[model samples]
Target: MDVAELTGTYTYRSFLNRPEPVDDFNKLRFAQLELRLTAEPDGTVSGELVFSEGEPGGDTIGMDMVGRASGASPFAFTLTGKGRPGSPVADFHYEYDGVILRHWDIGIGQLMTLAGTVLRAEDHGSGATLARAGQTASFLAVKRQA
Candidate 1:
């Protein structure tokens, strides 16, 4: 399918594969995400990602997103979104790559393979070379029907 075809809501889930079992490792392992986006003809992207974690009535947070799609066959894309807002201590930087599987019958819903690194704004640029790097994770999500 084409990137333009992905203009709706999708349920996204990613698994963390970190070498060290840090305190935040559990966060990535036990979260469910929902992405609602509109793909423009020019490849512009606008969306919001809702993340739910913990128990049934657990915490849920929203992130604002804007991105662009590239390539034709694989429909690779880059998304830059912010979560937690002005609260520096609670904020996060999300960066990821996504590829909608060419085949649909392989998984539960429209299969999408995703991988990316998530870090704090401070853990960037030349200064960050000495600081600890960000965390990386990869997983698959299925696009749900409208």
Candidate 2:
């Protein structure tokens, strides 16, 4: 997939980490993450992911993705954010798995729950996956039209 394929807004909900309140998904309510990515021809990838609903501290954290990716090679980026008292950053890695861009952040403890799958719109369909701490909860997302 390419930049044009990724230029859209995607909203996703994840039931990460268990034992709270299990829905039809069977896992507890974790949170919802919304992403908007703009890929530039100049090889600059930029996007933001918003966290809401599950816990505190998510809203205070600001995350922005900026990186580069090539054919078959993984998309490598840095997520700079106000994760702490002073702004800190983490590395994000994603790969196009033929179907979706499976991604994960370096993860700074409980600071950021940043791992998910992004599926670009194709002939078949578009969707996503949300997981946390090696546990993949159920997720579904849609691409909004511009």
Candidate 3:
């Protein structure tokens, strides 16, 4: 797929590890993730990622990101966060290495899916105390329809 195809707003979800199995008592809970992507002619991709609700009483976070398509790989790209210094998220940055997936879902119909791994390259705010830097998580995101 062309890089432009990946440009749009997407709803995203991530799992700390693999998700837990679902059962009668275990209902799935998901954070709200909004990814807005735009691609340039040179294959550079720019976007914003808004993440919320993963932790109890945690504040929603938004970060700006920039990256380019992986060499000769139209389906792949690596994006890094660009948090401003002194901001709430300034100390922490995330890097997402992802690829577009073409799949059909019975419930969601034809889907423009982006799946990959995300890395917390730096720790931010109070989280820095936890030393969570260099941690990685798997994520799945679907482009929203216009």
Query: Can you tell me which runs of candidate 3 are displaced by over 4 Å?
Result: 19-31, 52-61, 70-74, 104-108, 127-131
Winner by lDDT between candidate 2 and candidate 1: 1
Which stretches of model 1 miss by more than 4 angstroms? 18-30, 52-60, 84-90, 104-133
Against the unseen true structure, what C-alpha lDDT does each candidate score? 0.63, 0.42, 0.73
Poorest stretch of ten by lDDT in candidate 2? 89-98
**Candidate 2 lDDT tens digits, 1-146:** 45445556766455444555545763455446676667676556667655433346543343454555343444433322222223321222222211234544663332212234332212211245322223334343445555
Candidate 2 clash pair list: none
The clash count for each model shown is 0, 0, 0
Q: Go through the candidates in order and give the C-alpha RMSD of each one to the true structure.
A: 6.4, 14.1, 5.4
User: Over the full model, what C-alpha lDDT does candidate 3 score relative to the true structure?
Assistant: 0.73
TM-score of each: 0.65, 0.42, 0.74
List model 1 lDDT by residue over 33-102, tens digit each. Answer: 8877788888888887776443578544667778888648777777776765533223556676776656
What is the lDDT for 84 in model 1? 54
Best by lDDT: 3
Candidate 2 runs further than 4 Å off = 15-23, 26-28, 52-61, 71-141
- Best candidate, TM-score: 3
